[model samples]
Target: MGAAVTPHVVDSHHHVWDLSVRDQEWITGEALAPIRRDFSLTDLLPEARAAGVTATVLVQTVTVAEETPEFLALAADSDLVAGVVGWTDLTRPDAADALARLRQLPGGQHLVGIRHQVQGEPDPQWLLRPDVRRGLAAVGAAGLAYDLVVLPHQLPACVKAAQDHPELTFVLDHVGKPPVASGAIEPWATAVRMLAGLPNTVCKLSGLVTEAAPKTWTVDGLRPYADTVLEAFGPDRLMFGSDWPVCTLVAPYGEVLDVARQLTGSLSDGERAALFAGTATRVYGLRLSEGS
Candidate 1:
């Protein structure tokens, strides 16, 4: 008899942090108290393996330059981490040079994409700034994708940026972070659809659990948002991401995976496979071994 092929599930987004190394200033409020401690890859591997996740993309948590190298080194040593979406000072003039330096470092081959906390920026058009646009150009020139971690209102800028940098693939994280807790989807939905209209853009079906009402979110509550992205980006351009540690604020890692599975239950086997693995692998250019 022939051997059964294991499904190669890829967790396209997730994060880890160490408190002793640096303080996550954003984790100060009581609402984020539960996850204020160190969350290392050691804490994630067991959960990921149990969820049938063969590989994961470790995303940057802070905008610190030192953090990217640390993440790349970690990816170099781990079999589970297939790629890294690290952060660099995109506003700096040496953005391209910085990217080149990063690619030459240990585990540099795993640096698949770059991201900045555009969500935290006060300016909605931060991505459209002259300096940021230059950085975007550098990102594209370096043959790397840019991960957009922006809020709903900032999606318009994301659309414009994608249009301007057609060479760069803009990955929209958290489906542009919809207002799921309020169950409002007008502006967010409209903006997401516009962003999805760009062929160079992709969306991640992640972080929705935390966006919903704490401790009470259901798959049905997330259906509309998920459906919006699925229909807008299509399964081939949409990928699955756990958004762990942060998602743990609302649901456990296993529960988050189960919710995502339920939300995508109606897709065909091939479509589901694309969402769970194929899309991320293609977008990030992840290198996976046989059976992984």
Candidate 2:
């Protein structure tokens, strides 16, 4: 018999941080205390390898200016990290130059995208800011994708941003953080379809387990939200992300992967391949070698 084919897995979203190096600042409250300590790429390597993840996108955890460069250095040294989605002050007048400088830094070749915590912005339409728009244009000009970490309400602006820059790829993180715990899908579902209508947009099937009631969340609890994105964006535009340590709040890294498998079980092998690796490889312009 032919050897069983091992799926080529690319974890599209995950993060690493070291408290000794810098503070997360966002991991506040008792609920987030479990992950208060340091989480490094060394810690994630085994977990990822065990789960068949050959490559991963190391994402930005905090908005600190230094974090991106640090992450780039880490990615440069590690075979597991194929890409880095780091943060930058989009509102800065020199946003374009800032991106260019980041590219010139050590390990900067691994830099595939840029992200800001739009969820924390006080204004729902924060993406529409003039300076931010210019920064986004610069991102497109740099030939990099943009990762959107926004709440459901902010999706309309994401849609507008994607519409405005057809040349740029906007990856919607965590299915736009749907109200999975509440099981209320209307506004989120509606908004997701609108965002998916734009050809330049892609969605990550991640963070749903944590968004659902942590202890009580089952595969069924996450299906609707997953289904919404799968239907709206299709498998070619959807990718899997472990969400890692943050997902540890609700489910372990392995459990998160299992849940994703269950949610996408019905898809054909090629479709599942797209969700597991192909989409991310294409969207981030990842250059993986044979068997990676």
Candidate 3:
């Protein structure tokens, strides 16, 4: 038999935070208590290495302006982190300037994209807000992608936003956070198909485990949602993300990766390669080491 092929793996989504540096206010309530302490790259590197993760994209946790620079610095210091999806106030008039300033900061080259906690916004159509749309344009002009962290109901606006700015790449985080816990896929599935129809849109296969009933979620429980995105976006536009530390709220890092592997097992080797790493490298413009 031929030797087993090991595809190059890149975790397209994950985060690191130091509580002492600044409070992660969202880490409240009993359900999030397990990850409430500090979670730094120091803690994640070993786990990522064990999972055969060659590189990772450190994403923002809060909207605070200081967080992005900090994450950039962390990326600069770490060999494992290849990119960062930081946050900025998209409502600001000089959002483009802010992006420029960020690019000038230390380790700025690692800033691959930007994201907002759109799921928390009360307005379902928040992405269509004029100011936010303008900022998204700036992101595109800066040659950076935008990560969508919206709920299922908000996907229509996401489609509109992507339609409005064909120049920008819209990366759907957590596959619009499907209602896996309830097992209802109608609206979410339909909306996902709409968004996927747009050429600029891509998706991440992360966070479904948490969206499902945390205590009862199984690989079978997650299959439908995974299949929906797989069929809609295909492997070339879908990337794997651990959403770690947060994923620890349900399954450990390795288990989360294992689930993703099982979900994508039916794909051809080249397709699996794109799902695990190549798509992220292309979408985020990541610069991996020579042999990695």
Q: Which candidate is the best by lDDT?
A: 3
Q: For model 2, how does the per-residue alpha-carbon lDDT over 39-114 read when each residue is reduced to its tens digit? A: 8888999998888889999999888999999999998888899999998998998999999999999999999999
Better of 2 and 3 by TM-score: 3
**What TM-scores do the predictions have?**
0.97, 0.97, 0.97
> Residue by residue across 116-147, what tens digits does model 3's lDDT show?
99999999989999999889999999999999
List clashing residue pairs in candidate 2. Answer: none
Candidate 2 least-lDDT 10 residues: 1-10
State the lDDT of candidate 1 residue by residue for 1-292, as single tens digits. 1212226689999999998999888898888999999999999999988988899999998989999999999999998999999999989999999999999999999999999999999999999999999999999999999999999989999999999999999999999999999999999999999999999999999999889999677778999999999999999999999999899999888788878888888787888889999999999999986757
lDDT of 2 at 129: 88
The backbone clash count of each candidate, in order, is 0, 0, 0
Error of 3 at 109 (Å): 0.6
lDDT of 2: 0.91
